[model samples]
Target: MEYVVSHIPQGTACNRRSAYKMIPTTITIHNTGNPSSTARNERDWLTNPSNARQASFHIVVDERQAIECIPLIENAWHAGDGSGVNSGNRTSIGIEICESGNYAKTLDNAAELVAKMLKERGWGTDRLRRHFDWSGKICPRLMYDGGNWTGWKTFVASVDAKLKPKEDVRMPEEVAVQVDGKKVGVGEIKDGVTKVPVRLVAEAFGANVLWDAKTRTVNITKKEAV
Candidate 1:
């Protein structure tokens, strides 16, 4: 999903924005729990001086759009865990799914955002984590839905579907071989490597190519080397 970058000003209070550098290793999902705040509203509050709380996130996504309040290269105070090297706050890109309106749309948008991130970074669904995974807080509670873990599993499954890599057809393509700009023979390109009748191409260039079945080899001398 397309998101706008509206990062919090650099010199804000330590509560709103941290100075710690980050290279995100995972994605952490959370819910605002306010149930009535839009993505823009959450973003605004995050940057507002009056909203002084030690809780911040990278992205706040609602049905309409996603807003980035912090750079992915910087740490946010979303995870309740401490700012240790391995802490979620330092190692994860936090995404808060706004629960205010169009909850399903918000979920889908969040999933799309996460999938896009994973695809860009060559990550898998395994890199996704819940806020609860960092701290015992039941964040993203809507997906948790209580004790059974069913809803959480379903949400992860949806994200997995989005992030799964498409299979390549791997069809062999017939490629025409040439010698001195003249068509010689045809070769098949498969798995990114081309296979051709070497003897035909070699003879076209006035070079001898001999195949020895005993050694399973085709030896060619001076068609001039690459």
Candidate 2:
């Protein structure tokens, strides 16, 4: 499912826009480590007291909803290290799941949010990881100490589950088709499925394409038949 920010304030900014901006290559999970009713409330503690500690993360999942705390483009003060790619403060996308350090059900929601976030940003599951992997901090304690990595791992497993790559059917492979009295090329193999570049196929078939990008889905019909 497309990720919807439930409690995030509109117009959040992070890193600069780039055509190939890298999504979170690693995920660092943390329990609020304190008792808080909601992530929004916890965020207030983190941001209002800037002098307390300057840390930011992509999202905060509470018992009910996920609140986007930091923009994807800006580096958050999460990882606690600046030298490594896995560091939560700089490169890692930190997610603070509010827990009372005793009882919490944010894991399920955290997993769902992570899966949705990766899919939305076009990231793959290989990059999913935990906070302890980056730093020695025992965060996401449920997964680390209690042997509940299952939920975390399961979430990563769902990354590509819903993404359907477009099917690629080579023209007739070895055969040619007629289009408006013109011989069009047939079957050709391409890599990956779903969302194949229609331009190449259309060119081979002697057709053209016009994309309607507002919806973010490509519109492919027959190109000019000559």
Candidate 3:
């Protein structure tokens, strides 16, 4: 859950100078499209004001870690939506998954980071969207080229698995037995069954405990009341 922050300062085309607040309603996923670009490279590119050309995303994820370029509170020019009040840029957080070396690991890291964001925002898988969802751009091209378009459901399932509550394990309790105002034997309650030492209980009650030699049985005897 660690992220390297290399914020893209304001007053650039990628990041607007004015502070624009947004209540993230959706999580948009994208691919860097460049095969050789790593997460750090993308972050650094976004940080450079000279490279700010109306292209930026909140986070870029790679095999090793995720990098934050734009603040979540502001709008990133990632989605292909035009310069208007588009939901993709105004109300959604964009995440660019790097398709550099070890893309499988990069995908896993992106899924984990997205799942963490969903948990923190108290959102569900329904809020997840691909770049294609916002516009007709074939972004995250690997998903389509690798025939992984259907795998989007699998990714969402991974996020849901992360959100599942852990099962509670209950332990057994110890039971104490007392005879004549004195504790005589200790028992354990496990799996709804109680186990105690018969000899200890008999001895506490002044009964003689004997083992039969022939029948292989335990016998307890005490003076009978007349």
Q: Model-by-model lDDT, in order?
A: 0.88, 0.58, 0.81
Ranking by lDDT: 1, 3, 2
Identify the runs in model 1 with alpha carbons over 4 angstroms from their true place: 165-226
Candidate 2: list runs displaced more than 4 Å. 1-23, 83-88, 100-105, 146-151, 154-226
Residue 137 C-alpha lDDT in model 3: 83
- In order of TM-score, best first, we have 1, 3, 2
Q: For candidate 1, report its TM-score.
A: 0.71
What does candidate 3's lDDT look like per residue over 1-226, in tens digits? 3689878677766444235776678999998989999888988776565773767788999988898877788777777785466568787889998888898788888888888888898888899988888887887787765555766666778778877876666687799978788888788898789888889889888788999999999999995766
Tens digit of per-residue lDDT, candidate 1, span 61-177: 999899999989999999999989999999999999988888988899988888888989998989999999999898788877676667678778898998876887787999999
Q: Give the better candidate number (2 or 3) by TM-score.
A: 3
Could you tell me how far off, in angstroms, the CA of residue 37 lies in candidate 2 after the best superposition? Answer: 4.0
Instruction: Using TM-score, give the best candidate's number.
Output: 1
TM per prediction: 0.71, 0.53, 0.70
Worst 10 residues of 1 by lDDT: 143-152
lDDT of 2 at 30: 73
